[model samples]
Target: MPTASGSRARGASDEEPLRPAFDGPLARRPAALVARLRQRAVPSHWSSWSGVVSFGCLLVLVVTGLLLALLYDPSGALVRYGGSYSLLRGVEMSRAFASTLHLSFDVSGGLLLRQAHHWAALVLPASLILQLATTFFTGAFRRPRQWSWVLLVGVLGLALVSGWSGYALPDDTLSGTGLRIVQGVTLGLPLVGTGLSWLLFGGELPGTVIPRLYVLHLAAPVLLVLLVVARARSALRHGPVQFPGPGRTEDDVVGFPAWPTAAVRAAGLLVSTVGLLVLMGATLVVSPVWRYGPSSPGHAFAGSQPDWYTAFLDGALRLVPPGWEVVWLGRTWTLAVLVPLAVIGTSSLVLASYPFLESRVTGDRRDHRLLDRPRDVPTRTALGVAGVTVYVVLWAAGSADLVATQFRVSFEGVIWTLRAALLVGPLVAGLVTRQVCATLRAADRDRVDHGVESGRILRSPDGGYEEPRDALGAAQRWTLTRAAAPAARPSPPGSGADARRG
Candidate 1:
């Protein structure tokens, strides 16, 4: 054996090994090299699963929308030959409604395509509203996301415009009737009615109006997208809002990975598509066409119902006192135009200012991880429902003619009843809802301090009563005993979180 000095000199391969460093056997590789790397990527939290479903539905809308555009003639074109004065005259004409008729019966899959487009137009708005309700109920609109909530409400307006416009594209008897209603409402504006009508149609009543609407129907959605993009940009500048959950920490939140969430969303989209297809097919029952045949001025479609989203407008139009016309600048103006725009628009604007205005109203700075039970914040939420009720009443009144005749009442009576309900019902409901919420909230507060209410009322021989238990419910018990305060507005803008937002 070599001496100690010699062994040190040998140095266990201070020299190179026989094999290259990377040439080690595959089995010698550590398994974690692959596994560990996979574990650490973007933790896959996919927020907005419902929004993803909505986007998927929008995808279908875009495809169907394009087809409708191709089929529709936006020229306000009309068919005329040999001085035939009839609306359907001229065996061959190049007008827009004529083209729609051609598409309805002529195009292969055209009818199916039309039905799909119509169904989607209906479904998207309905879905968006439902999703908003979910967000509202969950109190997902609170804190860091308050502006996002406002943008969401605005999105509903966009959807309403888009749905209404898109629905008008077909210009079928039903749609034509709806268009006539729009013309009537727009023309009903005070002072500038005729000029406004001319500006919109480039002519008088019913001439090329469908084409003009087509232009608007097309433009509105585009404008909506731009607006949504702007609002979303503003939201991103701030940040997305998070919900209260186990995964969330004092400073942050956690959720299932993206892969799982995306998979779930995709699956939901698939189901929606299938369901829509079935709906479109089932709706093949012949649509009644003559009800709203080509514009007949003043002869309102005998039975008219506006699309759900625009129902409120119809309701508003119905409610204004018959003599509600106002005189301004020596010209006659109607509440029909100013009222809907003022009430709906102003209300939306005010609500949109909630993030900022509320902060000013209340001074709260601490980050809130919990949601307020709507009852705890009764006034605002109740007002929200009341606002919606008012809208429903208006939409119901839009069909005053039908309702009056159907029930053997004067159209005027129908309008007044709905108008009364519009003003009173929601407020009453709001108060009742608020009281119920407060009562429930108090009960919940009791449970946290005490245990479940056992409802075992014990009576002594003296007939005095004592209860053994105090309880609430799962939903009630889960909320914080003291409701989180609403956000307050700040004096000026700053880097840190502030309630002030528009």
Candidate 2:
């Protein structure tokens, strides 16, 4: 044991030499990625329910849209020979349109897919509405998030336009009618109107217009998705809109950690997606399939409805003067059509840029804590509601013929009635909305200043249960100084003495 070799062997054994084993080729990349996801995706303060829903809806829209895209034809060539002709004159179901029919009739679940696409399209706007409404109610769009709000409004506009593009792609008589409306609107512009219309049609009116629209319709949503990505980046830049508080401290917030909650949200999204697929399956059973017949220029669909999203546009067209024409620069333009476009475009632009304007007007640069109670902000809410009413009335205008036929009134008579309604309805609705808001504001103040109606029916001769109103959301609880900051709290007299007494 004391010999050199013996000592060396003993030392080696005692030292616990390295073991031979396979450290081969980096133990799988999937495990590494999963580890990274676990580390990065799970964060302390990032989870949103509304955002998740919107995202899910958008995903559905994209998937269904792609399927539709495969079946849809984006051509302007259509034949219209119902009987006794070469059967090639009116709008024929283009490559895309024919494919759509094939998808509906030929494919196993084709019709189901169509319904899914439609439902997804519908859900897209709904999600946007809810998301916007939630943010508006929560005051999440107050400061840093204002730009994102603008982007969102733009997204809504683009989404609507994209939906229109999709609607037109079917190339049915109803969509053909809708295309003519678009043509009229574009051509009705003051300058380069005809040029724009031509470009839209890829040549002349109603010719390659369907194809042009189809291309744009496919392209627009892609741009919107990119915009969404950019807007999401803004959320990172400005920090997400958080719950209101006295300060940006951790204690005031109530949110789950990002990962698990996000996973939960994903589950909800999946369930919604599955539900949409189910609904689509049901709707394809007997959709407005016949309404979009092969193709015919001679026979007009009695009252062809555009996709539901475009009901408003249909309504607008129906209200416009049937024969009113504008003579401009040696060209007769339809003012009825032009006016609506002007109104829609201007209104959209105004709305898109409104948040910045409002902030500038009020000089509000700080984060807002309280939610905006619609009642407390009467004028603005009223104005918005009035605008919506105006839009709806115009949308109903598109169905003027249907109305005329239904009510046995002349088309001209219905049109004139619509014109009157457009002028008067918004004013009345605005006044009413404002008055209602004012009343609610008064009630809110009374309740906040005084205690709520509580206490039981004490039978104090009056025999009334004094059920009181509860405190409002934090924002609504304060007196609404609409065009100004709220009044500062009055300093207590002899504050030091009061403090000592306390």
Candidate 3:
């Protein structure tokens, strides 16, 4: 393990040297672009496809979002419906709500694009999450790529905010309820709560929230594009991480060229993703705003929920005990809102700082290009499993009422059970997952060391039949051995000064 200075000194050895393929004239030349891009190589792995798919989803969202924006009106003015949908033909509603209805039923192919846009939005966060999980489990955030992880975390945060704000754009009863929840949550902060709420709504609940949220939803993509570009530049500088395999070196990546083959393949993936979104949009219904009607404080829908990405917060709120508020020094404090906010904020901080934290804890500062198998990093893998379990559990808790009703159980009992699960689930998951990883690693080691039975019957001197065993081939043995191998230790600096302690 090396200190920060030592890591910096050896940085050049850690990353593959890459040419600036798109600089100067090549970047501006449309004719030679395809050929030039094809010269850059990417890792030939299924995980690499995740980035391509995510980018495709981004394009789908942008195109569909632009179309939807053309017909959207973000005003709070109430208007009688004059378009299709006979049920609400003359019902009065806000212009924002009415515009969504018009887009859904009146405009040609409008509903398809709108629904596709939504489904793509949902897929965007999910894909980013998958990519992040892959990066984390593989320890791809080490050394030169640390900042790249930060940029990715930023992108994911913005995507969540964008999704939440976009989900609130329709101004239906469900959306309005979500907005109210946001307002209350914001207002529960200690000192800045009131001012934050004022800025968010521009006055009070149902005030300028719609127009403000519309701007935020639109602005998120522009920021996302910028951050993604930054992340790409950083990644190129560090080169793509590769898996350990035969004839593979730490100095370079082994994969296909990015231009002709990868570009065409990525394009095909994009087209397929868009086509699937279209199929889902046309054949399935989602977010039926017409059925929910326009936003009204007095009219509460029987069941309401935010999009799946934001449901964890809803779950946290539901799990909080009633009468959890506190009053001190002439001020009221609401733990119901504060607890969820704290959990989310703390979790974000931990995730954003994870790379540096791992480096400090492990005392290893060497640059790495080969990804570690999850089973080889038991502690980190277990932590990842535990975190994911908590997230899924919280998401389920968001629908506690439904669970209670469906199972014919006491709602209070369900809430209490969830609270208990929240406290105990992660500990169990972490320990169990760590043991599982250790066991799997031991099995892999055994397979590599002792080999497998070839199932051939052999007659011994005692007339006993036995199956013959075959050792793993050189390639298979090398692969498993390299995968199970520990990360290389950094050489001590001059004088062996215990730089880490210093």
lDDT comparing candidate 2 with the true structure = 0.63
Instruction: For candidate 3, give the lDDT.
Output: 0.83
RMSD of each: 10.0, 9.7, 9.7
TM-score of each candidate? 0.73, 0.75, 0.89
lDDT of 2 by residue, 91-199 (tens): 4455555665667666777677777766667767777766766665445677767888888887887888888887767666667766766766777776788788778
Off by over 4 Å in 3: 1-39, 459-461, 486-502
lDDT of 1 by residue, 141-259 (tens): 65666767777777777778778766665455566677676767778776677788787666755576666677777777777667667766865454434433222323442333223
Q: Report clashes for each candidate as comma-separated counts.
A: 20, 22, 2
Whole-model lDDT values for every prediction:
0.61, 0.63, 0.83
Candidate 1: misplaced stretches above 4 Å? 1-49, 80-94, 136-139, 188-192, 227-250, 270-278, 281-300, 365-370, 453-502
| TM-score for candidate 2, residues paired by index | 0.75
> Which RMSD does model 1 reach against the true structure?
10.0
**Model 3 pairs in collision:** 37-259, 38-259
- What is the overall TM-score of model 3 with all chains considered together? 0.89
